[model samples]
Target chain A: MLDLAILGLLFEQEMHGYEIRRRLRDELGLFANISFGSLYPALSRLERSGAVAVTESGGTSSAPLLSTGSLGGERAGLRARRSGATLGTKRSRKVYRITGQGRALFEQLLEGEEPAGADDARSFGLRLAFARHLAPSARLALLERRRAQLTRRLATDLVRASGDRLDVYTRSLVEHSTESTEHDIAWLDRLIDAERQKQAASRTDGARSADSTDPSDPHSGDAMTSSSPTGAS
Target chain B: MLDLAILGLLFEQEMHGYEIRRRLRDELGLFANISFGSLYPALSRLERSGAVAVTESGGTSSAPLLSTGSLGGERAGLRARRSGATLGTKRSRKVYRITGQGRALFEQLLEGEEPAGADDARSFGLRLAFARHLAPSARLALLERRRAQLTRRLATDLVRASGDRLDVYTRSLVEHSTESTEHDIAWLDRLIDAERQKQAASRTDGARSADSTDPSDPHSGDAMTSSSPTGAS
Candidate 1:
């Protein structure tokens, strides 16, 4: 999940790990802090796998002189210069950019299913956060896929609530949960309806403007705003 | 999280691992499948910690005769006879019941904070699911803590949206996500309000009816319905 978010951010701009964490927390609004422990390891793995490229360039080096005065710091800097100190001690800022391979991997991972019992709110939110990168059809598919998943979950919740064995509080909790799922489903339906309407509108606009300009592109008149529904997460 | 759910269920009834999974899925309506790999290890750990006791009892032996008369069946039968098999072919059934210590552990685990970047929809949902077991004050605290977490998240989300760096769709996604969090916080507020009203009502009732049944019990006049707002998840 973090990998998908990382690639999505890097696809926009090359960033160091700190920028990635900041963007993930601030922009994407997912993964809150995205601990450096997990972030660096994932970056290393992606770098090792050739999905992202890390270059030791283009970072402010104002404080490096004072930090590198110590003999031990000098030795560590030498080691870093040799093997590339990716962990960031004395400001060898590694700017990471997603490769063509990384873009492919990101798409693959975004299209993939999270492990069962782990995919609902966070995974869906992250995917939808990057939904603009998806093709129109793919975006529709994503919405529909989430709708189906939530529908199945609603079924299970309804079944669970039918048991009548819960106390007043637990039952209240279950009923409220059921209502929330219902609201989510209703929200998704509105999104799906909007997507379908937008797709249809774009198709009509495409047919009419086929002789003028390419209508299949995302910038057409009826693509985003014609019948935009509540496409919130 | 799973530990809290498990102990909550076991507080009601002694159950084996499979039963625990079923209850989690069907009753609590969380932890859909709870993989056996993790589940068994958790059970073993709890048993080792004396939080739960493994009693060898209470499982139907009817299914065992189905696949037994074939190769390796004789050895299985001998093993079952030796261990006095309670459920399956290869092993004795382990029914886990919460010890007194387990109840303490359950409360501790439920009250503990999940690491930042992790405590989220699932954590909040689990806590709400077990809210009935909590004291009224603790329950209100949980709801307020969640509200604060979400409120902070909403601030970050608004900041993220203001950058104007996102595409139309991504902006819509972020805006929608913000709205969703707002909805969640509002729901939590309702729950907290109801809880406060109930607590206040209980204090009043206790002052009035000094010799009656405990006014602050979970089943009192102001318990769920009196001031229950739209407290869905």
Candidate 2:
């Protein structure tokens, strides 16, 4: 989960660890609280896999800078070396940029199916937060999958509420849970409908334009937006 | 959480491990899937700590049974040996009853303050499921604590939503989450109001009767029923 979020953020801009954490907390607000304990290792793993490149970043910049090391042993002197020999503090800062390989990995992780259980809610929410990166079809699949999961939960909740002689509190909890799941399914339905409508509109535009090619394919297209449903806040 | 659920179930009736798991899933629906791996360890820990007593219940019987040992021993004359010499499976199955110490432990665990975190929802749900066992004041306190927790969450979520330039999908997720929190707070308010009314009603009843005392104090009084608020389905 942290890996997906980290990559998504880095995909936006090269960032040091502190800046990444700050953006995660203050900007995206996807993760309410993230510990450094889990963040550094994810970055290091991404680096080790050649999916990300690390630069010294001049101790101040959080952007990617080419390493001023001996590229050909002689090119080191061809251009004045950047002042990024040993940038960033030992631990709290080291600019990380997503490599071409990292973008591929990020897309794969974003589209992957999450395993079912307690982490399902967080996983789906995280995926939705990055839904703009997904193909419209994949985005629709995400919403549908969550709607199905919630619908199944509602069935079990209803069965428990009906069959069991629950006390007032437990019964109320189950009933409320069922209502919430229903609300989620309704919201997903609206999103699905909007996705279809957007697809149709783009397809018509693609057909009408003679000179312009439709970039509606997964890799080229912009994200589709959905209006809030009648079942919303 | 497992410990509290186990003790709460046993507080109602002495039960075998299998029966306990079934009830947890089917009856209370507390743990959607309570694995035996966790349940057995909890039962063993409770027994070791003198919080529970295990008896050799024949695999088929789910009722309380006397402990029997050494069928051929001379002490059979003092008391006839029960047929529990070779009862239950080797380890996975045993009848566990809450001991006097166990009951005390259960009460303490049920009434204890749960710290706010990832497990807060499950912990609060488990506590509310067993609210019948709590004193009225504690029940009210539980609802209020949850209400305060939700209120805090709502504030942070609102701030995040307001400050962040969220994508449509993520913005929707946050808005829906905020709405759910508000709904939960409304439910808690209803519960709190009902708890106060129950206490007030019992106080009136106590005042009405001069000769016969009203047994409407915390433990003796029945669980209060809260009507679902206008904020609910």
Candidate 3:
């Protein structure tokens, strides 16, 4: 879940790991909490698997100098250099970008079944925060499935409640959850609309990004949005 | 994610591990895939955590035996006697239920953060399936937060695409994702509506059949709903 959330969030925008953590905590409220222990390892694994590439080259030199910790943190620098000090002593903030291969993988993943189990408010929020990677079709499909499932479930619950004495608060609990799901689905539709508008707007530009227009864009370390040398092969 | 998927699907309705596996594959179309290996471990963990319980007393011992794989398997009887055994056997089927505590925790888990990084879709779905156990108010609050976040995000994506000649497909991709998010929010609303009806109906049936009662019904072995008794303290 954490892995999917991370990928989903990044597919929309490039972000540092810390930002990812913050979003997961404050946004989707997913279960299976994401922490440095898990996040860093997962990132490393993704990198190793070629699913992500870090934005380390352009700002590598200035990164180490901006260190907020003790100057004696030379150990950090030394460790960094040890990882292949390809360029001497420059600090680099490792920002990851999803690979086309990763995108295809994500598409396939989204096509699959979703994980189960209900979460508390906080956890679900975190999951949503990161679930931005799915294709619009997949997202809508999942929402529809959920809506149907929830509808049936609520009906069953009502039938069962025919003789029960549940308190108002408890009753509201069910209603609140159902509303939450519905609200989310509606929100997804709006997002789709915005995406369509953007797509239309982009077409008027008449030219692709420098990455597609000029191969030099890839070599230019400063080009954050350049398509990587690798495609979804 | 698979763990949560299994748990959440069960939250919607009780089923055996095999059925859970079948649903994960056949119903949900998850690409990450699940086997009895992962399913059983997740269920075990869930049971230990008090999110799920088994219902054993309902079936008569004299029930006709079927040549089911669960009971015929070596792990059946030994695992049952050691754990709660409830209603499953290689020879018989074990029916698990969700507990109140389990629901609360599932809700809580859903509201927490997911792991960071790309390429974790499998995890994402598993977490989403179980987001039903949270307090109603909290759930709504989380959904609202998600909607706000998506709004901000969709806006950002729009900004990024400005003045760019992004491919029609690429642009479409973003649009697709946005629509899905909108749909999710809408679905949340629907869920809330159905749940309200269910809760309202519950007040009428003060005492109903075990199936009709709240998932917290005591006699149902309640292990499937929450953490096991061992972990309760």
Candidate 4:
């Protein structure tokens, strides 16, 4: 499911494996960044499965194009190192693009909503990680949908957290996880709003942040901005 | 460190692998039970590394008996099946006991207290999961030590959870994880108290829960006789 999400995002833009990893980190804070433990094998698997195709490795002499995606700019340049270098040398990374089959797979993935098991910590992270691979509209729709689900859970947990009727330890556990999910849901809503704003703004001229006084500015204050991009403060 | 913890627990009693698994679940509640994904491999690795040694297989029977002075049980049964099962079930397993090397290794692991990086989720779970493997006295001591750590964390989080804080989303994430860990620490304390109570009761030639008066026993109102085990209730 996760790899499919990564592949779908890559389908939107050709990215080296490292870029895919960085995007996962930046775009989805809780999303597991692809590491050597999983990344190399997953790319190889995707190539074998025909879900992704890799371009030839980049030349050693080209100026390193740093990753500009979400995890801030500090470590982005490190993405270009050679696979075998000791230190300070650039690694050759294979650029991967989603194949036509990959898109169909992603579509299938989006169409089906797997049962979200609340018991698994990994699943919580996985769901949000894959949130971006959905069609932008579908992604917001899912966020609204998930927000509703979490709202219900938070309501129940609040009763538990505030009550003196239960064992203290058990109550705290339920309350803690509930609050965490609630935070994620609220952030998701903000993200959806931001995305919608971005879409509305795109329909006009593509300007960055709106100039409040310029009526012609697409990003004018007339349009409410969504919550900031970082899901967690 | 996790493997060392598991091995140390085994040295305390001749328990089935399932029993060791139970301790993690009921007591630690840290890592989910070692799945077939890691359990079989972990056991194999431990044996190969000579941290443990297998006794003679319960020969010729479908269920085999092996002793590591401390290690052995369901794992031996699994090992027995490993040799006889068809095709895919042929992974070899060997039961093991802590060698002198294993003991020394465990002692070294106990001396370290660094937070292993967030790189491996499994590693985090494993380390926390095996915390109970410390000597009962040592484990309880650590719990006391951790209680202080959690107290400080909970104090900080309590402020965040309170409505006076304005960073709603930020507060949510911090409070959630903090609350859960606090609950876990509290639960550990309860278990430690119960263990201490049981040990003290066992040393005395009296019924457990002997300190509390039993309401059900009409004649027990004034009597100094050992209270029924349910007296505490």
Winner on DockQ (1 vs 4): 1
Per-residue C-alpha lDDT of model 1 across residues B26-56, encoded as one tens digit per residue: 8777666678988889898888999998765
Each candidate's DockQ score against the native complex?
0.34, 0.25, 0.06, 0.06
lDDT of all predictions: 0.70, 0.71, 0.52, 0.50
For candidate 4, give the DockQ.
Answer: 0.06
lDDT-sorted candidate list, best first: 2, 1, 3, 4
Clashing pairs in 2: none
- The TM-score values for the models, in the order shown, are 0.75, 0.73, 0.38, 0.46
Which residue segments of model 4 deviate by more than 4 Å?
Answer: A31-33, A57-93, A110-120, A132-233, B56-100, B113-233
Off by over 4 Å in 1: A58-90, A113-116, A207-233, B57-91, B113-116, B207-233
Instruction: Write candidate 3's Cα lDDT for A1-233 as tens digits.
Output: 55666676677678888888875544432332466888888887777777777775444445544433236767886676778764664444568888887665654454455544433222233333323333333444554555455455545545544433443323443344445445555654655465555445546865344213223223211222243424334
Candidate 3 residue-wise lDDT, B6-33, digit = tens: 6567767788877777655544434324
lDDT of 4 by residue, B15-88 (tens): 44555666544443334344555555666677777766655434444343434344546577666556764225
lDDT of 1 by residue, A1-233 (tens): 77888887887779999989887877766677788999988898898788998776533443333331244666776676559544444556778999988977876776566544555677888887767655566677788888888788888789768976665556766777777778778877887787777778767887654321223334433333343344332
* Candidate 3, position A216, lDDT: 27
TM-score of model 4 vs. true structure: 0.46
Better of 1 and 3 by DockQ: 1
Docking class of 4: incorrect
Q: Name the top TM-score candidate.
A: 1
Query: Which number leads on lDDT?
Result: 2
Query: What is the lDDT for A10 in model 4?
Result: 73
